[model samples]
Target: MDLEVRHLRVVCAIADAGSITKAAAGLGLSQPSLTAQLRRIERYLGGPLFVRSRQGASPTALGEFVLAKARTVLPSIDAIQVESALRAGAAPDRRPLRYVATPGPLMVGLLEELRELFPGASPALRTETHVPTAVDLIASGQQDLAAVVEYLRPVPVPPPPDVVARTVATEPAFVLLPAGHPFATRPAVGLAEFADAEWVLPPNQACGLFEAFTAACVDAGFTATIRHEAESSAARELVARGTAVGLGQATFRSTPGIVPLPLAGCPLLIRQVLLWHRDGPLAAHAREITEGAERAYAAAVRRSPHYLAWLAERPPPGAEQGWAGAGDAPP
Candidate 1:
């Protein structure tokens, strides 16, 4: 079989995730399919590229060499595509603006801003449950812009060369518990306070949030007993009905029977990012979209009474500054 950029990406994903199961999730592929593909690639190369163990898979010598070359080649290829698109004036004025995002209240606010920014230009919207998939869509020119959530630890995965990403906001995660649950009325609760509580967390493949949530639970000296798996609306519904507790953004709207509390010590954080093809039709509006996202987040913060109270107790420096200036382009 011939090697391709997509195949190279598969290899990199496996190396980075350290396991086929996790890598498949990141790639939006099934584990079994990815495993079979790996076997074929290995056969084509005449040797195994990974050493699998109970913990995960590690690259073999040949795998390391190939991966190293892939890292260099893929980015260059991406750059060429971007440059070509730019020179070709890829932005088509007739096409409706395409926007994709991970599900959340933040997206609602962003869409509102978009409407105000481009009057009469209704953008096409898609909700991707996985951040990497949303990013890949933008990188592949399948979407014009994407709003994704990422964790700040272990370093965020870099955007593909064809894409440019900027951080619109960084906010601490809040705990959502049953309104009558103990510590629900507290101003702020530490992770340890919920060590024994049942968690309704999104699957790890949803984004880095899952991993961060698990790590925080471990740091608090207990493994979280995740009883349900859902993301966005479903997760919120479970928390609201008092079926299980979950984590949410600071701007989480409190529904009846649901209490959102700031995590004391702020051990977990979620970064909201906007990504778009660097040379695509939407590139010209990148700054505007980024600014809109920040404004939307700031508005959400102001709307959340619980978040407001937490900010009042220990205000972050420049808390009052509008979020427009808070954005920074990710490397």
Candidate 2:
């Protein structure tokens, strides 16, 4: 049978993952099916591609050669698909851009920019609590693009195949406290300082923020005492009323009864990425969206007095300087 780009991708996945089971999971295929396909591929090439052992599969000499070729060919195919999608997006019959994102300050700005970019096309904007869900939608052609925020941990999860992601912004997270809270007057507060403070965190499934917050607290030698399940609006209100404290984006606006303060070491950072399928029509607009989000985040920082003060504070060495000035705002 003639080989295709998809076949090459499968081979590369197996090689990179170093196991059929892992490769199958990454490729969204069943292990038995992937194993069968590998056998057929081996037969078509007149040789075995992998050396199977108790640990995992390793590439044979011939497998290494084929895998190298696949690596080279797959990227070229991806480039071709991206270019084609760009052309398709600009075509006269192009559909209106459909985009989804987790609701936040960055998305608020991104949607506005998209509207301005495609005035003729009424782009669809959707809110998804989970970034992975947005990524899946874009990959499945259900959406044109997605704005996702990933909390960097010890091990970061990779995006799905055929989906391209661009880092739009990377900024430190902040602590939102009541205006009258003692910590509100501090230049910066550490997660450990709030160990005994009640936290108003969103549900674990709402976004990566909850997980990141808890993880940071753990690293600081404390467990966050979650008193209320809240997000964006509710979290704001809770912090404002002094009922609980919560985490906020660096670009978070200062409310009447709340203050946003940066963390002492800036251990928690959120990386905002714009994602789209390489073969989808919206691939061409990814850059436009990314640039727009950056601008919007900067604007938000400028409007947020508390964020400005947090920026003025002495950040720890090697801290993210990307969000220092209004030009480098992050959400």
Model 1, 245: alpha-carbon shift in Å?
1.3
Q: Taking the tens digit of each residue's C-alpha lDDT, what string does model 2 give over 109-145?
A: 8788877766645667888987778877766555677
Error at 161, model 2, angstroms = 1.1
TM-score of each: 0.66, 0.66
* Per-residue lDDT over 1-331 for candidate 1, one digit per residue giving the tens place of the 0 to 100 score: 7977778878888997999999999888999999999998888888999999999999999999888787656544554554344445453233455689886655778888876766545566888878778877776565677887765553345677667777676777888888878788788888997877898877775467666777777888998898998866788888878789998877788687789888878878777778777666556666777778878988888889988888787754221121113233433
Q: Which residue pairs of candidate 2 clash?
A: none
Where does model 2 exceed 4 Å of error? 1-94, 312-331
lDDT of 1: 0.74
True-vs-predicted CA distance for residue 309, candidate 1, Å: 1.5
Single out the weakest 10-residue window by summed lDDT for candidate 2. Answer: 321-330
lDDT of 2 at 237: 88
